[model samples]
Target: MDETLREQQLRMTRFIRDPHANLPPPGIEARRLAVYRQLFLGNVQGLLAGSFPVLRATLANDLWQSLVEDFYACHRCRTPLFTEVAGEWVGYLESREDLPGWVAELAHYEWIETVLLLSDSTDPAHEPEGDLFNGVPLLSSLAMPLAYVWPVSQIGPGHVPQKAPGEPTLLLARRGADQKVYFSRLAPLAYALLVSLREQQISGREHLETLAELAGMEWDVLEPQATALLLDLKAQGVVLGTYSG
Candidate 1:
């Protein structure tokens, strides 16, 4: 590209991204610039609104618009894909200190749906009906165990928490075989077990024994309860049975 043309393109992009702080390119008419600015900002806002419906509905209209506008102006997104815009928006919210403490957490909680829906990865090779305790347990590639300080799942227009609760919230987000995403609350032990499964490729029995030690209980006593929990996870599609490979 020519040096002058490159500069002109940069100016136009800067103005479109943040009209208040930037001047339009020299040849563009103010009427045309306004159209371009609104078009770009509207596209960004629409993507974010769809991705974070709960957050969008919880905040006042003006505040939400302002927040989106600020993100458009200030954030330098790493990706050009529109589908990934929500993730970028979450990163922007996480970086900001001016917004409410729960804003980033809520945005992230909402963004997980988009991530799982668009993910291309498939579950690893494993026996769907294999024994979970004897073989290495297989956690579905699409299943994610998340811990948030705020009750992100319960937050909405009707329920805005003033302060975070004493205990962190443990939630499971998974993409089912039907191509639908689901969210559910998780008990602390359940969360720990899932996290361990995700982080370490170990047998279910070993995982349970470790958990029993952590909880200060004998393996014989915890085995029944842990086995039941594992069975339930398998039924829910969160646990894809024991690892076969």
Candidate 2:
């Protein structure tokens, strides 16, 4: 590429990021640039706002925009396209220290819903037999584990809800047949077991044995809770099938 073209391409990135810059084009005039500027930021803000409605509700519009702007400028996205901006936006939130800790956590808490909803993961296609706990392995890939410092589920339009849950919240972010994402809470032990199962290639029984040891719960004692959790995981579209391997 020509040096001028390269620099101009860099500037286009900077311009889109800055949101107050001139639109770069022969056809884009001053008024056109202004329109594009607002339209561009508005689209980003709307997608982010949709993902984080509760967090947006916490801040005034300008404040929220400023927060989004800060992340927009500071982070270099791994993706080539602009439409897939939320991943970088979420990464920025989780990394920045200048922002309020709760806000960053809340932003990540919200962004996860969009990530799962838009996921293209198609690896797990095994049918559920619904006997998830009969000495069979259980896991959830479609239903992912998330632990957040801020309890984002409770807040809504009407009121400023509690900042954190009474305990650390273990959430399962799952996608439905229609591709909508839903949040479900899990017990800590259950969450740990699910995570271990999904991560390793161990047989289902071996995974439970390892998990039980890790949790310091005797397998005999935790058997019921573990079984119940596996059944729930199956119902929620996480477990693909019994681990025969």
Candidate 3:
């Protein structure tokens, strides 16, 4: 006999799920129900396709359109503010254990540029005080250190052809002194160090030691590569500040 709140909520959710579903909930106008549906779907599609331009070009439009719809319908975004929908898209792939291995990796690669551009940091992340070779600081915000199980950025025009690359590519994306964006491929060890430092919450210098320890690599070999990685991270504006005492 009672109109349950749970039932009402589900009814409202259906309106969002099916754009054309006609429901006259007070704030929403019945006559223009389809407009809101189309508008919401359109904006999301643009961002998704824009981030994965190469992938969008590769897939049939219908398939691509369906992908965006699935993401919209299922994803409960962490950030409601949405300046970084692209980052959340990357997060979606990074967290999904069930995704096809190649598909998840490619999504991460395709979404990288969007993540960098929409990163709202006016200043770089904290950099630590240390010497290169003696020990080096690793990268953080203001710079985006990226790793993919596949080489997404390198597959431009025809380099990797239609399928995934045999090897992974390490990418460093950062804003320069002049505020221009740059991306460079990194060596596996350097990428491992940067990724460990950023995503794993390991400190820069310690992360290098981590790689060396894990691989039984001589710290001597890690020293120069880690040093180079830090310098490049700083020059690219990755270091926001020196880690303080």
Candidate 4:
């Protein structure tokens, strides 16, 4: 690109991104610049509104608009793709200090659905009906166990908690065979088990034994309950069955 033309493009982009702080490209009419500004911001806002409907609805209109505008103007996104804008917005929210503590958590909670829905990754080779205890248990590639300080699953316009609760929220977000994403609150034990499954390629029996030790319970005592939990998870599509490879 020619240096002069490159400079012109940069100036226009700055003006479109942050119109109030930037002067419109030298000879462009104010009306034309306004149109460009509105078009650009409107597109971004529409994309984000769809991505974070809960966050948008939870905040007051002015606050939401200001937040979006600040993100648009001040945050330089690493990706040029519109599909990744929500992730970028979440990253931006996590970096800000002035916002409420739950804001970033809620945004991340909302963004997870988008991430799972659009992910191109596929499940690894596994036996959907294999014995989970005898072979390595397979966790679904789309199943994610998340822990947050705020009750992000319950936060909304009418129910925003003034402070985080004593216990951190544990939740599982997974994609079903129908291609829809779902979120469920998880018990601490269940959360720990899932986290362990994700981190360790071990048989279900071994995983249960480890959990029993962690909980200070006998393996025989925990086996029945833990086995039931694994069965339920397999039924729910969270567990993809035993690892075949």
Q: Candidate 2 on 1-245: residue-level lDDT in tens?
A: 89987877676656666745544644446676667567767777887887777788886778787877766666677887655676677777767677665677777777777777767766544435633444355464567888866566665556544445567778878878887888888788777877877677565566677778987889998777777766666666677676443
Per-residue alpha-carbon lDDT of candidate 3 for residues 31-139, written as tens digits (9 for 90 to 100): 5656766778888888777777776675556866776776787777888765678777767666767644555666666666566666665433433555433333445
Query: What does candidate 1's lDDT look like per residue over 47-98, in tens digits?
Result: 8888899999999999898889999999888988989888898899998898
Candidate 4 clashes between residue pairs 3 or more apart in a chain or in different chains: none
Q: What's the residue-level lDDT of 226 in candidate 1?
A: 92
Error of 4 at 7 (Å): 1.6
What TM-score against the true fold does each predicted structure earn?
0.94, 0.76, 0.66, 0.94
Q: Give the higher-TM-score candidate: 2 or 4.
A: 4
Best-matching candidate per lDDT: 4
Once all C-alphas are superposed, what RMSD does model 3 give against the true structure? 5.2
Off by over 4 Å in 3: 1-13, 19-32, 91-100, 121-140, 156-166, 196-213, 217-242
Cα deviation of 3, candidate 1, in Å: 2.4
* lDDT (Cα, tens digit) per residue for candidate 4, span 107-182: 9999999999998898888899999988999998999999999999899979999989999999999988789999
Q: In candidate 1, how many Å is residue 202 off?
A: 1.1
